[model samples]
Target chain A: MEDQKPTSILVLDDEPIVCKRLKSALEKRGYEVEIFFRSSDAFKRITERNFDIVITDLKMEGLDGMAFLTEVKKRSPATEVIVITGFATMETAKESFQKGVFDFLAKPFKLGEIQDAVERAEKKIKGNIS
Target chain B: MRILVALDTNRYSQYVVNEVAKLAMNTWADVTLLGVESRKPASNGTQPPRNLPIVRKLQEFREEFLGYFKDESVSPYAIKRWGYELVDRGKGLLEEMCVCKGMKDFRVRIRFGQPTKQILTEAVEEQSDLIVVGCSKGEQCTWEQDRNAPEKIVKAAPCSVLVVKEEKKPTKIVCCLDHDSVSQESLELINQMVTLHQTDLALVGLTESEHLREEVDQKMKQILQYYTAQKIKAWVSVVDVSLLDKFIADTAEKGLIALWMGHKSLIGKFFSQDRVGKLVRSAQSSVLILR
Candidate 1:
């Protein structure tokens, strides 16, 4: 199968550095990457149906990663969600997994690890869409 | 992309630094130059001593390696302030060299403990996209008492690990479709790297016997056609098991070799251990074992 278009990725992080780093890395890999520092802005973009994958930081000021993912999945079940949390606990990890999150990574994770998770999630999206 | 480079007292680590500098500049990636020193007892168990002298080995290598590098901006202000020996020097040199190469998002991190453990831990904490580590000549390339640091990191790292034997620009990106499956994961990963590097693609198919040749050839065509549909053209070759080693070495010289990785893979298991360590080390370019 051929994807005529590039994969669209939405990255949400409270930390600007995290968003910028992920944007550059994923952009280099040919994904159209957009970064958002505010959860409200990210939530708006998700409802607009722009991105194929949503990578959100678990801990945020307004909307936390879990609630954000849950809301995204409810409206757009096909959209893949990958949650990254710096303060990962067993309970939160389980909750995200049960919520059908594509993958949950503990913070200070490797960029490669996140990339791999995104690729795996992309396959699921392709399967769902096709 | 978050890229962590592990610099040590070895001269080869300089090559890793240069390679990272050029790569980070081209990719606009965030770079972290990490130097891990052996955990030694602080004479007072409190503050470190001032006026840290440069490690003789690190100094010697820097002079020799930098002699060819025309960048005069590679200074060690942090090292002069931190008051440590070789490792602090490594951290400063790597950061300075990256800055000289026009990289803006670069930082130096120094840790005192087991090098492999600290490097791996940092890769996790920083969420690095890639880990570039340099191994010394022979098997002596280790962190503290940890044996096979290179191989261990290659296996244990959560992200992709690029083991640099010597610094050279990649001419081609090689992807071996030797697995029984359609290689969906491997192909997807390779596609990303290929897009980023814009290097030539060489797909190698391994057939155990003559009867398997037709199937491998057919799969090769399918993969090639898939790429073609995506507007990416690639060359394909079918090889017997006996010629696999030579095939890898020959392909590695161009740029990168992407070998399918798993515990069961003959190729991955071979290169991930000491059995084929020399083969990988001697390759002309960098090695990326996709897991």
Candidate 2:
């Protein structure tokens, strides 16, 4: 029964389609996912509950991905943060690694790409939790 | 096969020489030692002495260097040349020496030039399958300060460059995957490197949302499928944040890890720095970060 506990993931993105698509896709694969449309909402929930992985879009209206990543690390240092963004730059990529982001994803990303990220996260989580 | 150990008469050069000898012993390839003298102007401008004493000392140093390899069965030759201006001349001399020895299968030519360009050009011209270079400690002299040589060689060389900083064997390799779109290429490269080095492969996926597990799974399947098709020997495991420490520990076992990150995934400014630095510093294994 303990082994059957669903891998919990937190998805933070403003886009409804992205969240819904990921949520549905992840749920089908036996993972429990929580979605947040706003960075603040995601931050609040993160403080309230533990997540194995956190995937967030880099660009948002307020409390952008980096800031969200910082808060995530502050609150749940164990949770691995992966940032997804459409605009890719070398400086930002370096910064993500410096900030200890587990991985970086570019926008317009394929479902398979997101899945790959989740798989890596899941592996990390399993190693930690079990 | 012949290997060239570019000797610079420095401590770093000794390590390069030792590693090359070990590799030669393992591969049974002949070794060549090349000593290059750059005629760049001295900052002091006193026409720094090129006295006969200095020449005699260099010759003695060369002989002493060759003495280290005397016990080994490898046929060794030494050549000394002066100045970047005479690079073509030096190469010609090396070519003549190789022909004279009647050893055509493999030849190692070690010479000092602008370390990066000379190595790359000679590797291509010599059709070397592998180029091994020692990382400079940079403490004693500023000669090898540019660690960028490895990166530059990777970009330009026709063959693979084995950049050796310390004597270490890779036990774990981290393959950074974005999706199946580029996974095949990434996996193929990873598989070749792992098999060549006899190392384990760790698959790392970065997700933007928690709900992307299915997508990630499918991609992993694709990667594994390709590896299976190729019949490459590797241990594949998926890692997420929760199990990162365990993954790190498992990878740290051999104290050497290679991280394969596709350049495409490096898109955008927000996530770049953190991603690069995290993998660079945290892992216990020596990192081979591939672009």
Candidate 3:
């Protein structure tokens, strides 16, 4: 028998409230979570270590979410990236899906919605491994 | 925060609901969906029938608004069922209605009278923090019956008002700050708008004279610092008080124009009531009158 490693998630949004709430909610659900308010910092951390899942915002200050997620996929194809944005459009959603994003959620969404997204992502991650 | 959404049976009103839903969900504000019908009640003061076209349309609007929050297992503003009571005040039949209760209030109401007067009265009675309304796009923002309803609400609202023109998304929010008396609530509202649009923030401060540049700069710096701390991409510039009007007109075409006209705000003094109404009608983009 071997000890199992908990699922690790990295959440990035320029809005501190979004980051904080995601971190708290995800942690409560038995997941290890780290949050960043800057895309640059999140990118640096991503380059350092790969996480099981990544949740990001489309619009950010220095480096936008789309570019950051592309780099994440380039490094680790298995890591699922879920995008949550305040300014959502059909074009952005299509582009995100084309880039192989796991899920897309709009801002002002209830906590339950993200949790469901995370659960679905987890199932897909587990399926790929099995 | 309480939000009063004044709607008419038009395409303009249909689009405004989505905008209001975004704001309401973010702020968790108590919301009231108001519909005004330009009809006269009977002389006997009898209540209007429940199946009037306007009432049915209002119910449809309510459903559309609630659709935005449907996926959640436990809704924040939970609604049970539609309920209404007909109360006849002096003016006409005022239907005070609600669809049950939740942590926050979501109500659908109907009024019979003039559009502008009814909307204004609802704002005052609900003690709403903001009013969200829409008008036609182009040179004139005409309602179904009233042509200048949106402009009148912006000019006479006791609280802040958001006039949504076209469904165009703003690339930036240009907040014109003329004084240091901006309220924290107003700033938070601007932050929400910036986040909603995923746009940059441009702060324009007013300077009366060459020597006043330093003072205005200092004030702008303070406000700029606040947004910076919030991790919002923001910048500031000082405009001569004389050129403020021209600056706003130029910027309004591209971004949302947010004017902080609090009670003690100098911007209120600069832009008179008539001027405020004119700005609301003439701006190419949407306008946010922060009171």
Candidate 4:
């Protein structure tokens, strides 16, 4: 029998404060969390390994969130992606869902919102495995 | 940021609370839920009874407020250890209820007196950045207890005031200001509004003359750059100060209208105090008076 591995999460936001806060909050919840301030850098890392969950901001300097999430889904269909944005619009939300995003959150969201979203995503992953 | 929420025993207050909750969730603002229990002429200077109906209503408001953050797993503010301690202050017995989760300050204060005066006093004492209050929908925004409470608060509050006409979300936000002196906090508040409603933003610049129009254009550009960088669906347009009133009247019917009425604001100079109050009363949509 093998010991269960902890869930892995990757967080990307251009704002360092957002990344830093989410990193600290998510890590305290006993998950393996990695953060990136640049979507391009996050893209590079995602290419290197697959993560169970990816949390991203929709608007960024390069490789915008939509494109990144599209790639994530293409590479690993089972991975859950949550989209957080300061600029939330109906079209973007519809598009994100169309890209198979697991959840969408607006900026200034309470830490609890992201926590709840991740927990739900975790349950789905576990359910699929079992 | 400090937000003073004026709640009464009405469904409108719930709309106000829900709106504020959406904002506070994002900003982590120090939130003060204020309820005023109007005193009878005979009971002017006495301690309010513990079982006053307003006290019970305030408790319900507190619970409805905290309910928005119940799913919050990161802070102790989410804990259900709610307690409020009332204190006497000679002039008006104020019940100060403290609910803390480390850094955030979420408290309830029950004031005794006129609703408008109590809300204004609390805004001054707390030095609140914004006051959130709701009014019934119609050509005249009314409160159940006081017919003119919302109008009075919007007119007299020392800080910014948000008059929520109803709980309905606006399709867009029209932010009107003449200069770039808009504070970062105001911009952040607009950001929170846009996010909560998932709406578009329209920046309207006001100018009186051709020379000032150029400056207004520059300022609008700077503001637009800020919102565009944030990735908000925002656009800009210039409106003459002469036509500002008409612009506001027309736009208010379409979406939420925010006016920068800070001391440095030229828009503040253009809109008289009564006009500001009237606008809040007559506007078909919610209004945010940014100070």
Q: TM per model? A: 0.52, 0.40, 0.61, 0.61
User: What tens digits encode model 1's per-residue C-alpha lDDT throughout B1-291?
Assistant: 567887776566777877665443233345677766666445564354322221444444444433433432321111211222333333345222222322123566666677778889998888776788876544455433454577677767766677776776677787665554453334544554665466678887766753345555787787788677545669886667667678876776666877655434355322334434554445555677655
Q: What lDDT does candidate 4 reach at residue A106?
A: 63
Residue-wise C-alpha lDDT for candidate 4, range B38-64, written one tens digit per residue: 874343455556677767888888888
Checking candidate 3 for backbone clashes, the offending pairs are none
lDDT of 1 by residue, A1-130 (tens): 4576889999998778679989999999899899999899999888888578999987677888888999889887777888876544445655776787766665444567678878878877787768
Sort candidate 2 into its docking category. incorrect
Over 4 Å off in model 2, which ranges?
A1-130, B1-113, B127-129, B136-148, B151-159, B177-199, B203-223, B226-233, B238-253, B261-286, B289-291
Candidate 3 segments whose C-alpha is farther than 4 A from its true place: A1-130, B43-47, B50-53, B80-99, B208-216, B240-246, B264-268
| Model 4 chain B worst lDDT window (10 residues) | B73-82
Model 2 misses residue A42 by how many Å? Answer: 63
Winner by TM-score between candidate 3 and candidate 1: 3
Estimate the Cα RMSD of every predicted model relative to the unseen true structure: 15.1, 23.8, 10.0, 9.2
Interface RMSD values for the candidates, listed in order? Answer: 14.2, 18.3, 9.1, 8.5
> Which candidate has the highest DockQ of all?
4
DockQ of 1: 0.04
iRMSD (Å) of candidate 1? 14.2
Alpha carbon deviation, residue A8, candidate 1 (Å): 15
Q: What ranking emerges by lDDT with the best candidate at the front?
A: 3, 4, 1, 2
lDDT of 4 by residue, A11-104 (tens): 9998787888889999999889999988889999989999999999888897999999999999999999998876555467657767888777
- Expressed as tens digits, the lDDT of each residue in B1-291 for candidate 2 is 334444444455555555555443233334455444444434354344354332344455455545544633223232212223322343345222222331112232334447667776776555454455544432222235333454455445554334444555566666644444442223433444554355566656644433335655687676666555444444555555545456655765564454444444345321243553454333433344443
Docking class of 3: incorrect
